[model samples]
Target: MLVTPLTKLLGIRVPVVQGGMQWVGLPPLVAAVSNGGGLGILTALTQPNPEALRQAIRETHKLTSKPFGVNITLLPTINPPDYEGYARAAIEEGVRIFETAGNSPGKLIRYFKQNGCIVIHKCTTIRHAKSAIRLGVDVVSVDGFECAGHPGEEDIGGLVLLARAAQELNIPYIASGGVADGRGLAAVLALGAAGANMGTRFMCTVEAPIHQNIKEKIVASNEQDTVHIFRTLHNTARVFKNKVSTEVVAIERKPGGAKFEDVRELVSGARGKQVYETGDPDYGIWSAGVSVGLIKDIPTCEELLARMEKEAEDVIDGLVKVRVEKAKL
Candidate 1:
């Protein structure tokens, strides 16, 4: 297979990027992904402070010399104490890739670029992708409606969004959302994407820090097991079907339904942190994409990569045979 711009830019053998999922994208998981020939991402906020992030980076380096990235979600709730300090620390740690989400980094993008980091901002819409490209980001991860963790209100799928981005921008982009296996990877490549960014799929990996209960739940799920909630607040998120999510949807459907603030309290970030770490599903919110249903087992990152490559090659070979038969006919 031909290497895409994403592989070239990230200096990875495979174009797959393990999404910077909170609680999940830690040093162990990140190192596993990178060692498996894919780009592993460390969630910057997973650490308590910049020094912690730097320490985690060092640890990941010790595990694998492969290239990796860091994700820093630009959200309002983040403590404003040392956001820039964290960025600087990551740069000093020799982290070359930075992934931003939630809001535009704007000037922060420039600062990272100045420090020799290749920025790849995640956006759910074409407009946002354009803005990132204009800001001189090396690449963009176009997250579609199927993605977890705040998949914008536009509800655009990767197919339409990637086409739009490819037509409008000259920069390379990877398709995120609804991507789980090699078939999904090949599909995105067919849709004009260079590669795919995966979150839920990586969560099912053995290296992920989530509890076994959570991993098992993902393996048993299907496409219909996901639902989008909090649309009223303009912060729609695709999550697994759980007691909390069911309640959120039930409330949303009721006449004169509860206010966003009310539900917001029920699904607080602190609560989510606990559920994700402890596997107490009913305790709080758990952000997951519909792709969770497609995941079947908790394979190691290396195993997953090998399977994906084999499957992708087989799929491509089958397609080539079909074309040859059609020509003969």
Candidate 2:
């Protein structure tokens, strides 16, 4: 088995992590990933309230005894959900791992650490990763420009981003973006990431809990099938290239550019949730990473992870052979 700091830290057998996706990170998917030897995460805000999140946690416990996590995204909202209450709910329910994203994790970090939780903060830039480290995050999930959802303002892809993180950061980190296969996993490992955190890839799994049509849409799409919306508002989000998303981009590029208010309805969470339930690919703006180009089939989490492990091993072995041959000259 390929062991890394991430595996050791999370007590997982593989270095694959299913990233927390809104609407998609439910119990089935999360439990499947954890049972398949990767760390799975539920999106806390996906629950309607702290009580709802607590119930979700309890339900997940019924599904798998393996390690899983909850993602608590802290964003600047007019009426924010009770972030502390959600944290308390997770802690009370015996969740030992957490994935925090959006805004500064300063306030939440202290409580999570105090509870003996292993915090993995997602960052779009090395600077932000450094700040998270100072806040006592145990690990960093470095997101690249190729990631879905909010990839921050920086446009660095995993190539330069992961390498830069390896050069500067002292703690263990995982690569989050454009990772779909064993080759991608091996590449990230070579670039100094302890593992690869995949959102788009996991979305195509059998237990993803989304409509089959959506999974088929992802399989049929190439890397270029994605577009970035809300770039003008400076909270650029990478989403699938569909009618709704295309229109959102057009509206953003209008005369004086646009604000969040202008495109709010188009990118509403409700609409995105409908796309998954109704199986309509173009019904709304849905997040997807460039890794969509690499997904060819919707395999079970067990099947996918097994294949990835073999593929990563083969790739590493091939690299070693190449180096040995070159050294003989």
lDDT of 2 by residue, 1-329 (tens): 89999999999999998999999999999999999999999999988899998999898999999999999999888898899999999999999999999996899999999999999999999999999999999999999999999898879988999999999999999999999999999999999999999999999999998999999999999989999987888888999999999999999889998888888888898999999999999889899999999999999998999999999999999998876444564
lDDT of 1 by residue, 1-329 (tens): 54888888888877799999887889999999999999999998878899999999999999999999899888766456367877889899988899988775887899998887899889988888889988889888999988988889988887788888888878889999988988888788878888889999998888898888888888887888888888766678888778888889888878876678768777777888888778776777887897886788899999998788777777877787876444564
Tell me each candidate's RMSD, in Å, in order.
Answer: 1.9, 1.2
Which residue pairs in candidate 1 collide? 221-293, 222-293
- The lowest-lDDT stretch of 10 consecutive residues in candidate 2 is 320-329
Best model number under TM-score: 2
By lDDT, who's the top model here?
2
